[model samples]
Target chain A: MHATALAHSNIALVKYWGKRDRALNLPVAGSLSLTLGGLATTTTVHFRPELESDLVSLDGRELRPGSVAHRRIADFLDLVRNDAGITSFAEVETANNFPTAAGLASSASGFAALALAATHAAGQQLTDAQLSVLARRGSGSAARSIFGGFAEMSAGTRADGRDAHARALAGPEHWDLRCVVAVTTQGEKDVSSTEGMTRTQETSPLFEPWARTVDADIAQARHAVETRDFALLGRVAERSCLGMHASAMAADPGVIYWNPTTIEVIHRVRRARRDGLQIFFTIDAGPHVKVFCPARELSALRSVLSQIDGVNDLIVARPGQGAHLLES
Target chain B: MHATALAHSNIALVKYWGKRDRALNLPVAGSLSLTLGGLATTTTVHFRPELESDLVSLDGRELRPGSVAHRRIADFLDLVRNDAGITSFAEVETANNFPTAAGLASSASGFAALALAATHAAGQQLTDAQLSVLARRGSGSAARSIFGGFAEMSAGTRADGRDAHARALAGPEHWDLRCVVAVTTQGEKDVSSTEGMTRTQETSPLFEPWARTVDADIAQARHAVETRDFALLGRVAERSCLGMHASAMAADPGVIYWNPTTIEVIHRVRRARRDGLQIFFTIDAGPHVKVFCPARELSALRSVLSQIDGVNDLIVARPGQGAHLLES
Candidate 1:
């Protein structure tokens, strides 16, 4: 069987930072995110009995079998094969519309699409929650990308990881929130989230308290989303982002993901808010910033953000759909 | 009676960040610092019976009586008067060799000198510990400046804050550690550490854990200093600095102190370390970075840091003496 799926990238409002279980990819805290429109990954998977081994290519570049990227894909495929009880070698090709590994949540879309495509290609039917679990096994944020609009990833108590998955909080039409991604650098980050998270969890003394208070953040953020309280949501989201980055920075040797441009964008966002604009900023593990605001304020947000010296480009996105099968 | 005192600034190897009591300026965590040579603040205080009001001047500029700086001076004088049982208005003159409110710890030396000079000029005799306690009421880190070489400030459990004073860990001859201060920006920081600490303590979730773990950090750092372990001291010191800044960054509006040049200095420090230099970088709540290393490697360290794009100047300092009376 051959299957294709498309998944849009997500920007976490309440970030899923440290991992509870590194092997199972279990998060220490719950997270919330909005699947973004305009930037996505389309992944295709084909299981062929004639193939001797799995092959993986990203953006038309065929990766060597033992390389990190190829190994990650192969490992993810192994999980799908185990679930479906299939031994056939597979060929996977994935491409993203935005920059990869530059803190743009590309992995969320990539793994979400791969999970759906690989599972379907292997003739297995799974619920969205099950699919989310499978996606999370590859990348934690990918679990949230399985749902549209507002989604929450539960940091389940189960040791088996059966309950750890994403659920849709609201659909795309729930609110008219928009995200303006101020792309500072398209280059990949020096430290990947996987490495950075592990380093922080192991080395940072602040990680315990950070992990301890994440539930409160998630609860407050969820309430704000339900009530459509823009200010409250912005406050919680920005706080979560800064806390996560702080944990990384407090790590041994320190993982500083922010550049000078990142600070500039943050100051600009704060300045705009002070000037009566209802925009707030949150950054992932890279220098780029995502400004959250309503569609009405898009023009003003763009004007202020574009005026920044180091901002390379801006990609505006609204709430988008979850991973779905693509007709081929 | 009139007295003059001089005190040098101190940089916290283990930072005294959040306050346990805002009104008394009591720290939530104990801190360790190295009193710096070559940067001193000289303060002179004279008690006069005829004067109706306290007069204060900084660097030959007469401050208005009701101004914030003047008020702080007057309030400090009131404390001295209460202690010495003298009810005389005072004239105060203070000057710093470095930038004020720029995260250079000028307040540390300023208050240390003020505490010593004001008390002596009022015909009051106090031990170094009492002087440290008095200085802390003015600025939290100022307590550390009352001791020379390596000093530790106790985060006292008492409500009266008598135990929250600095003590000398090692005199100036104990270690040969030198600090190369890379001045990225000479301008004053936008947010004062006093305001920034309060903001973080009030808003940052990470502050609680940061405060909780500071004891362990202090113990480890103290051991490193006792053992004369440069690498261990560097690691712990760097961790403490990052954690303090993390708490600040996790504040509601966020307090980001690093600029592009600051980041460049950090990277250079790391690169230099990898190249076999025994140096580590720590930043206070400002753009400047203090690179700690041995005196033997000062020239090499200077060459590397000076080549960085944003470093405006470098000041090299060794362990220096605590506050002492200067003959008028």
Candidate 2:
């Protein structure tokens, strides 16, 4: 069996920072995100009876068999095999159109594509909800990438994590918003999201309160999306992003992900908003800044963001489709 | 009547962040501080019947009568006048050895000196505790500056704010520690501590948790001080500082006090510690970093800190005496 799938990266309008369950990758808070149009990952999976072990490759480079990346893929494949009741080994190949591990949410698109491709190649016909849950086990944010446009992940109360899967809140046609990604650094972050989250959860005294307040923020974000209120959406999104980073910064040893350029971008965004541009910024664990703006103000925001020193490139993305398997 | 006093600036070993009563300038958490030896503010107060208004001058620059700084001084004078039952206007002159409003705790020393001078100038012989309460009305951290070496400010439960005052933990002779001030930016911050604290209290979700846990941190820090455990004291001190800054960063508009150079200094301190040097960093609402180190490591810590690019000046301070009358 062989399958190929494409998945777009999703930027959380309302963030999912800390996790409730590390093993299952269950988020502690509800989050809302928009699946990005241009930045995506394409993955292919082939299950062969003749194969003895799983092999993983990224952008044509074969990863070491027992390496961390390879082991992650193998573990994900095992989940698919258990579900499909197939003993055949698989070969998985993934490639992304954007930078990896630079706070671009590449893992979200990567794992989403891998989950769809692997499950389909294993002769499994699962609904998007089931696939979302499965992808979440690989990377929590990947659960949201299973849906297009506006998607929400519930901080589910279920102990089994059945209710934790993301669901589509609205399709791409519902809003006319644009995201301009200001790539300050192309290199991967020194600390991974997994490690950073663990450090934040363990050492930050503020983490508990931040995690507790996410439900209200998610509700506000949902209402802002429903009303198509760009300003309200931006406010909630930026606040959530700041709160998440705050927890990380308050960790015992402290984690400072922002550089001089990052601070400049934040100030620039504030100045633009003061100058009557309806734009707001959100950053994940890395230095890059994603400015969300209304379609009409996109050009103006782009001009300002482009002039900022240290911004190597800019990517404009509109709302896009969810992860889907391609016929093979 | 006239009086002059000198007071040393105190850097919080544990910070005094939020205020429980904005009007009275009462803290939401108890704080510990080390009164700096070299940085002092000298303030003189003279009351005359013919003076129409309370005139204020800082470092030979006469402040406008209705200006914010002028108003704060006049307000503080009113408290002293009310206690002594005097209706005379006063002229106040203050000067500092260190930069003002660069988060070197200038206001702490300034108000403490002014409070002692103004009250005495008005013929009121108040105790140190009474002077502390009056100084806190001008600046909260100034309360701790009324005591030498290790000082603690109580976050009193009294609604009247009478119990919120500083008390000495130990004299400067109790410990052989040094503070090296790394002045990264000479320019004043965009947001003042008063404004920043108010914004953090109002907008930051993390502020509640941060305020809630300060007592526990204070206990830990006190224990560390008692046992002469530099590592444990430094750990608690740095964590408290981080938590304070985190709350500011999580504020609605967000107040980021650190620049790239500030971050570099923090990393350098951590590196020095890893290399067997006992040094820790603490920052207030400005870009400068203050590194606390053992007496033995002073030269090495200074050498490393001096090489950092943006560090304009370094001030070495030992624990010293608090506010006292300056003979004129």
i-RMS values of the candidates, in order?
2.2, 2.3
Task: Go through the candidates in order and give the C-alpha RMSD of each one to the true structure.
Answer: 2.1, 2.0
lDDT (0 to 1) per candidate:
0.89, 0.88
Give me the displacement of residue B105 in model 1, in angstroms.
1.8
Just chain B of model 2: what TM-score? 0.97
Candidate 2's C-alpha runs over 4 A off are A185-189, B186-188
Question: Model 1 over residues B126-154: C-alpha lDDT tens digits?
Answer: 99999999999888888998899999989
Tens digit per residue, CA lDDT, model 1, A144-251: 898999999999999979899999998989999999999885432578778898999998877877888788888999999999999999999988999889989988
Clashing pairs in 1: none
DockQ for each candidate?
0.62, 0.58
State the lDDT at A6 in candidate 2: 97
Instruction: Report residue A193 deviation for candidate 2 (angstroms).
Output: 1.3
Model 2 interface CAPRI class: medium
DockQ of predicted candidate 2: 0.58
Every model's TM-score on chain B = 0.97, 0.97
